[model samples]
Each structure stands twice: as C-alpha cells, then as structure tokens.
Target: MTTDDKLVYMANQIARNFEALGHDHAVAATEDHMLSFWDPRMKARILALAVERADALGPVAAAALERLRAGVVPRPQTGATRFAAVDESGASDAG
Candidate 1:
C-alpha cells in the first residue's frame, strides 16, 4: 500500500483502539499516540492527507488529525518525566 494509505490505516487502527474511551478521550488518546510515536515526517504527511483526503480516515482519527493541523498537540511525557525520583510513599530510592 502507499504511505498515505498506510498512514490512514494506522490512524484508523489507533482510533479504534481508543474508541472505547469515548469520543473526546479517544480523539485525545489517538492524537497523543501519534504525537509520541510518529516522526515529524509521518506527522506532516498525515496532516497533508487530512487536508487532501480526510474521508479515508475514521471519525476519531480525522478529528485528531485536524487538531494536529491546528497545533493542538498534547505534550507527551518521556520516561524520565513520567517517573519520579521519589516513590509514591514519599521515599527516595537513591543513595
């Protein structure tokens, strides 16, 4: 399949996976997933496809793409940012 086609399929799959979360949440999740996992080139390509041929994408995916195109990106937390140096009990494991 063409790269654009693959991107559409992938976006749809991501949308499907997050659909159980409900509309708003699913769109956010799909957007976050793409932002965190897809490279800049992939994102740009998808954005172009979103404008040129959005009907190929699922509803949630299309919404997410529109959001991305509009610069409503969610900041993805990296491993270091997601994990705290202190434990949940307020104790540090470092020596």
Candidate 2:
C-alpha cells in the first residue's frame, strides 16, 4: 500500500476499535487532533504503529490521543517527550 493509503487504513482501523469501545467521539476527536496537530511525518508514525499493532495498541493510542486533546500534557518518557508535534501544523492551544 502507498503511504497515504497505509495511514488512512490504520486510522480507520483505530477508529473502528474505538467505536467498538464506545469511543466514537473520541475517535473523531483524535482524528481532528491528528489532522491539525500532527505533522505528516508524525501522522505517518502514528499510522504505521497503529497498523502494526492495532489489535494491541488501538485502545491505548485512543486514550492517549484523547488526553492530548483534553489538554493533558504528557510527561517526558526517558527524557523524550511522549508526544511531539507531528508536523509544522503544531498542537492546538485550545482544548
């Protein structure tokens, strides 16, 4: 699959999992977060990981994305920011 196709496929798979978990709004919200805040590269990473481990990571990923949207700052992990701007679009200040 092309990169764009892979990303979209992963995003949709994650969304389906979230929806099954009664997190449809969260899915939509997370997608908005990705689109607005994530750079193309970050989006690619998120999607790649989502596709590779969607069965295991989808719920956690959704929760993390929701926390991000809710203005909860992620703590640095091992001296690295848990979440980075996916692209130049940057994170939204409004929560």
Q: Candidate 1, residues 41-90: lDDT per residue as tens digits?
A: 99999999987887788899999998888889765522233334544543
lDDT of each: 0.84, 0.54
The window of 10 residues in a row where model 2 has the poorest summed lDDT is: 74-83
Candidate 2 residue lDDT tens string, 1-95: 77655655555565565464356455554565466566878765765565565564566455655454465653332232334366645345432
Per-candidate TM-scores read 0.77, 0.38
Q: Candidate 2: which stretches are off by over 4 Å?
A: 1-22, 60-95
lDDT of 2 at 65: 50
